[model samples]
Target: MTTLPDSFLSLPIAHRGYHDAGSGIIENTRAAFRAAIEAGYGIELDVQLSADGHAMVFHDYEMSRLTGETGPIRTRNRDALTRIILKNTDETIPALPEILSLIAGRVPLLIEAKDQDGAMGPDIGPLEQSVADALKDYAGPVAVMSFNPHSVIRLAALAPNVPRGLVTCHFPAEHWQLLNEKTRTRLRAIPDYMRAGASFISHRHDDLANPRISELRAAGASIICWTVRSFEAEIEARKLADNITFEGYRAAVGTG
Candidate 1:
């Protein structure tokens, strides 16, 4: 089994770069990422492949959620996407290289590869390939993870030295309903973390009590939990996870 770097377990990750729309610091924007770096927190962000095959740092397959534009993120090429403003802020969507340069290795970065099955089939390989290509020469504390096991496996093949993780949740949301039983079961069960060469696991904060997690923890696997919004939630997650990816409430972070 691959052991994750100490920084991966020690740092308090800023979910979406400590985003706060109320302050005009939109999630996945340059301003938000700078805030995390200035505050000395690791960053967790999502990336999707643009139409021209560049890795763009943004969340959701569609641009509407975080931007005024309403369309799939892939429809726009990198240059076009980089020029568009995000939400109501002055910040524009950033490319992966821009973010990597902005940080300049000031803190750790966790890149989540956003992908899913599409009309053409599993639409994750190209996304993984693009992300891998972007990070080829990035000399920083970094890791890649995905809710899709295939992406994780691909990263393992394409960039073996970079840490890989499996992001999972047991919640039965409506999205899971759309997946076939086999695919849904694989996602919920998360049986390929070890097989996929993942060095760590990032699970939903509320779903950390599964037996598999406990067994992995017992066997010395690194575990982290995500989107912890409250001090109370962080405390609960800390009992099972080695670290936290959090937002909303900032607490005194300990390296424990």
Candidate 2:
């Protein structure tokens, strides 16, 4: 039962490392991370496993969106993946270790392990283990989370000392077509909060008023929400969330 530190909750987090694609700072790349660190905001990024099992800091499972290449991210080894320059930038995809070394505890990090198991089921591993291995020796104010509870459960076993959380959201059927109705219904309620050994939850910002969120807060879980794009939205989210993960605009530091 590791606790989330105050630093993690004190400042607004930059969703995907303060990315601004128009400025050549792509999401989850070194440039974006550097921007976040320079801006004095906490960072929240996603990680996926490369073919050889190295942890890569990226959001998409496929390369087509972020890179010129076309294939699943796991199809490429770390070295090859690192060479595929991000679209519109000279920067290549960064490995977890590279970003960790760059940040070096300068600000709190909230890392989300992308669900390799497309159905958000139990077929998880290599990625969580790689993340654990990366963090084993690093000293930082950091936490790991995922939309998949099984991934968080795995993190508890692999890196028990680091704080763990769940990325929660309303499972709107149209948006979550891959998840069956039963699965969506079960997850929408967030029943795994206790079972996953989560210290906090980074829920969807617009869904903050969901009663389950209130229930979790009542049970003492630190409430955080994601993708707050405007200061007005931040003000609204803060009413229910202990902190916010934001992007697209500058979030005032130490003000919430």
Candidate 3:
């Protein structure tokens, strides 16, 4: 394993490629991915198992939000999924393997998988073997991430050497004092994240700078921020995060 950076953890990261709002080049699409790769940016995209256990690139819980469909994406096979028109364009969701093959070694891909929660229609259940199986032959830098800690555990077990990142953010639900107390306990156990063989962490830049990242870094973990677009935030985060993922690929100081 190569050593990464503490400042790299806080760098400017793009939010799923630099697609303008309401533009056809939306996040997780092949066009957006290509743009990111061409721009030399570290790209972040989502992956979910299809009906046939093949990984498909997507970020939403359903296609309705992007494609205006009422059904789920996992229910359809590659052909069917490919046929489902995406927005105004004829392009459909691309398979994960295909995306990797296309990108080759041009850039690194950050894959965020769905949780075991079966609520968002049907897809492959949370299984380490399943995720590992799909990524077995993938060359170049690959990192798996999910909000579900259990999924992180399973992925670590299946692929001991593969880097896993735990994605988390504070939701507006609990009281400050209560949330702080609960967060402390959660933070303590997070060192166990290293036990999960996690090489990096994909979290909000604010979270990385909140002392938690330093704690995790002490455990020999790479801290990476998600969706850092602001210039000020980028500068501040560069002091904390090890690798910065951006959409436009404006190379600054440091590398992953």
Candidate 4:
């Protein structure tokens, strides 16, 4: 299994590229990524497959939330998506290559491939291939992960040399309504860590105390937590996490 780089564990990653919608720096847009790069923070962003099989840096499957446009992001081709400006910003939706070129290895990058199969089942591919293609020539401290184990498994095959991880959490039914009880139960245990060849996990901050997290860490998996919004939460998350993926507040370098 490929190990996650030190930079990923050391840097306080910017969730969704240090995005602050209040500041017009929309998540996964060029402005947000540039801001994160300027702040010297590692960037964590999400990608979805465009209709044409290109990887687009975006968090939601639907464009309505970020772009104020209608329909699923995959319903639009890359060119069309690129033409739609993000809400409250001049930046258009960026392709994976565009963001990769913009960052140019300046900071650690963490890419999460959103599950194309709403149920997080075996249906996955084109998006993983697109992401692999984008990173084929990228020289950087970068890693790929997903909440869906199948996606991580696919990434392992597609980008064998690139470090891979799982985005894990206790799948609370209310928050994970799309996933069935059996799926949630299986995922909560993170049974695919070995099968996916994952070197690390970015678990939900509140769920850091889960015994499985400690078990994985004891077995050599790096622990990372997501969406820490304040210094206090960062402090709490650090008890179990090797690093944090944060937004809304500046994470002091080297603070525990």
**Candidate 3 lDDT by residue in tens digits, 119-209:** 2112324434666876788777667777656677777667766667777554333422334455445543454465445666776666665
Runs in model 4 deviating more than 4 A are none
| Tens digit per residue, CA lDDT, model 1, 78-177 | 9999998876888888889889898877888999987655421255677788888878889889899988787788889998888889888874746565
After superposition, the stretches of candidate 2 with alpha carbons farther than 4 Å from their true spots are none
Q: Write the per-residue lDDT of candidate 2 for residues 1-256, one digit (tens) a residue.
A: 7999999889899999988988888889888888999999999999999999999998998899988999899999999988998888898988999999999999999999999999999999999999999998888899999999999999999999999999999989998989999999998999988888899999999999999999999999999998899999999999999999999999999875
List TM-scores for all candidates, in order: 0.94, 0.98, 0.79, 0.98
Q: Give the 10-residue window scoring lowest on summed lDDT in candidate 2.
A: 21-30
Q: Which whole-number lDDT from 0 to 100 does residue 107 have in model 2?
A: 92
The candidate with the higher TM-score, 2 or 3, is: 2
- Extract clashing residue pairs from model 1: none
Q: In candidate 4, what are the lDDT values of residues 214-246, reduced to their tens digit?
A: 999999999999889999999899998999999
Candidate 3 lDDT for residue 23: 65
* Selected candidate, larger lDDT, 2 vs 3: 2
lDDT of 3 at 89: 69
